[model samples]
Target: MHKPRILVVDDEPQIHRFLGPALNAAGYEPVRADSGREALAEIARKPPEAVVLDLGLPDLDGQEVLKRARDFYEGPVVILSARDREIEKIEALDAGADDYVEKPFRVGELLARLRVVMRRQQRQQEEPPPVVHAGDLVIDLPRRLVTRAGEALRLSPKEYDLLAKLAEADGKVLTHKELLVSIWGPAHAHDMQYLRVFIGQLRQKIEADPAAPKLILTQPGIGYRFMADEALRPSGA
Candidate 1:
């Protein structure tokens, strides 16, 4: 299977070293560009699914690179810079950045953000299914029904909602804050313990072996994602 390609544009060798394996583990093929000119060249050669860009470049400013890429490339660009000033973020967003994360970012969080931005772009181009089937697990969104190997599973309202949300995410990581706000509302946005309990409950019901779950994957401190990949589906499914 061809993993989604992500362009990592940064002058720092350390950044490239850190992100390359992380991107690969998160199901992305990392393409490297150490300078602004090289980054532009790579994009022109073959635009990637998304880009992780740094503001400081040896050849040209990162903003200038973004502006130039925006002229023709429509892929999402995420600013991954050391610049933490509010004005820098505003300028980057105004210049067409899909998202921004500062240096010393958590790898899990950065991966989650990348998934979110890329998923947003994908949603703009396609419609999601109301039904999700991963192996023996089937989720019927409209009917709010879930089953394992054709046996109907009983789930609480919150469990069903959480499963539905993750299934709809299509393998993208749904950040803890995003999931909490959507399900438990803003009032319970910081309730990580509460979320973990529910996740544990859901896993027990859905996973063949709850201790070694395969259906619903965890992103450590970030959140959860359903393991729904095209490669895992039946042929022509």
Candidate 2:
């Protein structure tokens, strides 16, 4: 099997120095880009399976690079930056970032996120069964519909796509990359913010209590898992 390729876009040499070896050790081939323009150029030349994008670029804003990348590349994008504000994180996620990490992060966490993303991607390519059920929420793949408690729930295209991906995985955790690619196409494989917004929407429509969700569950820094409704029910009742 071919090792997954990851494009690391950062202006700092130190980032490349530290991340290259880390990614290599994690069984990923790392490609480097020092600026937003270079990153775009490299993507145009040949796209990778995933990208680690820095928000602070010398030539252009990292968000702009992310948007442009989504225009063509279909894969997961993990945003790496020094910005630690909650609003910034939310903004990036909404813009289509699959995941976000502040600077000075642990290599172990990064690798874990990578694995989650890739696993989901592999599952999607396999094209498993269309209809998926998680708890009370039932996803009708062909109709792009979701229902809970026997009532049809209206969902945006992106929201429906997100549910379908998670439901397909049953209870397995899906990384940000996997969800982004499955819904927004390959070009948006890195936009995590998009996932956040759609997830919020999905919960609102499906979860009995959106604030304290029992279904669409978050896995901290990793990703998300759609709890099987069957598992939530009492056995042999």
lDDT of each: 0.81, 0.76
Assess the local accuracy of residue 62 in candidate 2 as a C-alpha lDDT between 0 and 100: 90
Local accuracy of candidate 1 as per-residue lDDT tens digits, 158-200: 9998889888866555677778878999999889988899999
Per-prediction TM-score, please? Answer: 0.58, 0.60
Off by over 4 Å in 1: 1-7, 13-49, 54-124, 229-237
Query: Per-residue alpha-carbon lDDT of model 2 for 39-113, expressed as tens digits?
Result: 999999988888888888999999899989889987778888664454545556657676666667877767766
Best by TM-score: 2
Clashes of 1: 0
| Most lDDT-accurate candidate | 1
Worst 10 residues of 2 by lDDT: 228-237
